[model samples]
Target: MNFANRIRRAGIRVPPPARLVAGLALLALTGSLLLMLPGIGTARPLRLNEAVFTAVSALSVTGLTVIAPGRDLTVFGQIVLLALIQVGGVGFMVLAVLVYRLIGRQMSLEDRMALRDSLGLLSLTEIVVLTRRVFKVVLLIELIGAILLWLHWRTLLPLSEWDAMRYALFHAVSAFCNAGFDLFTGLPQFPDGVPNDGVTLTIFAILIVIGGLGIPVVADLINWPRSRTLSLHTRLTLFIVLWLNLTGALSMFVAETLTAGTLHAAPVGQRFGLSLFQVISARTAGFAGFPNLEALSPGAHLTLIGLMFVGSAPASMGGGITTGTFLVMLISMWSYVRGFPAARAMGRTISQETVRRAGAVLTVSLVVVITATYLIAISHSDIAFLEALFEVVSAFATCGLSLGITGDLTLFGQVVIMLVMFWGRLGALTIVAALAMPRRKTLVNYPDAQILIG
Candidate 1:
């Protein structure tokens, strides 16, 4: 408090968005330092890049990894990583606010505004109540998931009760946070992930979907008085999620079946599960089940890219332009094709400004992904164009799924991925909005431009 007060007295005004960004950075840096501790590693010393990368990945809730975390980090380190995931996944702001409220600290107006922004709440009036609800929702779901996962592991895999429970808790948080992290890397039967196991995949997939569904949608669903009373946002989000997952899974199922070296030999049921899991994980969950990514057909590659690019819904743990924004732009374009002056959905009229903003986000995301891809491709000439594109999209979407190229990138390429991960996690526009504070106070409106283009 004194530190903040001193900074305030020094005539330096720090905006909430900027402060939020700073707080996340501080957390990452602290986690990185902790990861560097000698006890965190097993005999071998932790590399600078490894430590920093893991910290960023954990804090961003992006599961991209250059090394096997289970093999590299000790149990203590894993716990630290878990803490970062929970804080990052639930959001640092909400956790901080929760702590403050627990200690009976009065949330100031600035704090309230930050909470409102962090949670994507409509107003500040009910933010406190909403925060309390979020704490309950996160804890309850994770707890239940852990218990169920432990039971499943004991029944399916050969593991002791203690070990199973430990793995269960770790994965439960990872799955719920949409972190895509798994501790099965060095566990013998599961080298990469539990690819062939339908039971485990089902549990992970459920957690991923629930986590990818934004907090606003979750809260709305939980609090809705009736089915008919659902908000348009909730309805649109649910519809898009269902539509995207169905189409994405079906596309992968077909593509993989057609591809000779892929899931063709697997049983029909297993094939279906793998396809469904991939599509679900592709939308920012970062888990890769069955038949190695490199073995997949070219068509499947393109499909995965599209899913990663569109990502999950906004105000969610996952990144991308968000399902809502992507669909709004698509619907708006279709509306324009029919000569409608404005975009409309579910009997509600969309404002021109909203349409424009969606377009802007989509445009900026494309530019960032393309530019990063080009840079990485040129520097790492050995890497194929498609692979480069996949890495960039995964990083920019904060989706950790990869074609096994993450560890092979040059220092420059790794830095590019890191920057993209940072920007994608916080959001491209959000960084701009945070750093470039608006100062114009003009009441007079300028005439709109009449430029035309195809």
Candidate 2:
């Protein structure tokens, strides 16, 4: 067989979860090398560690970085960064399927299964059609966002026409993808951050919200206006998303106002905008309305940590246990408290399997954050416990909102954070499944073992 056929055969033998891990790893490696090539850097080429970390962060669509993209990299490098974010956000499998179709090669059964797993879809039916439509929607949204951003920034920022257009497009993709990378961070004019005017923040907030909504929800919502109906999953996602943002915003505003922190002495209107923007950014967007995060009170920090841990929805550009998983867990707890036979939400019963999966994800995610935090705390003596915890949670959730400690981390600590980001991006359950060995089914049954009560 030819090289391509041989490679395909080998890939087919791997489990879907393992295939996904391998694909992202390979892409990150290639991106790392590309980022180190001549003319990519602003002054000197990136070091091995810098390149690897940047590649992983961008490919995972997590915004944490050791080096500043705007100040340290050339325009070419920024373009490369953008490319990685796009591929990572849209999913490499989707692009692979697209390429296969373009080459007129039919996807094998194995390929279809891998694609289905990547998209987190329950069924394999119409997977190809759905993939095509998803790509179209993603492109359309990004295109529109870029155009609007260009118009908004044309007169606001001091830049030539070409640079203005470039910044607009770059920020548009970064915002819509929930990647959190920003060119404005490197600009001297905006030391803390660019202006957080209501108009700019609103545009970004809308994109972030849409991007964080899972692919299935987005597709479903497209037809909802005509159908005047919604699925249980979509309803739960929407309700939780709305509730979280509102409550988060309110809590943040109260905390900051009481502590006289970031919002101190600011106009009521501006305070409201900053509060909502920060809460929305906490949901995996990572853009900073108030860039001096350390200035926020402990209460505000705690609130942000909670929101980051929750993250965004499943199969979204962002990461977390997902809104669906979080909602199911909440309902499950309520059902148990009420002595109900099954967990229910919005007048529909949730399956036991989904509840179990949510619990597993939450348990594993907690362990990951706790363990990483302990390791980081020991490695960096100067860092505070709360800050370490926050950083670990941010990495684990792929939220990318740091308390300005990313640059101060040791090499070992940085590696741990990178691993957490990778784990967070693929998800705790997916990684567990990928690492777990296959087992054969058995018809045998045994009596349940008795256990002590809590």
Per-candidate TM equals 0.95, 0.97
* Worst 10 contiguous positions by lDDT, candidate 2: 3-12
**Candidate 1 whole-model C-alpha lDDT, 0 to 1:** 0.84
Q: For model 2, what is the error of residue 241's alpha carbon versus the real structure, in angstroms, after optimal superposition?
A: 0.4
In candidate 2, which residue ranges exceed 4 Å CA deviation?
A: 1-4, 7-12, 225-228
Candidate 2, residues 249-298: lDDT per residue as tens digits?
99998998999887878997788778888888888878888868898999
Relative to the true structure, candidate 1 reaches a TM of 0.95
lDDT of 1 by residue, 1-454 (tens): 6787788789787777787788888998998898899889876767888888888888888898877777777888889889988988888888877788789987877767766776666677777787788779988999989998998888677778887898899988898888887777656666556534777778888888998988888888878855547788889989999998889988988897877548888887777778888999889788887647888899989998999999888878888888978889988988989898789888889899888878888998999999999999989989999999998998888889888899998778888888888878887657767988578888998988998887
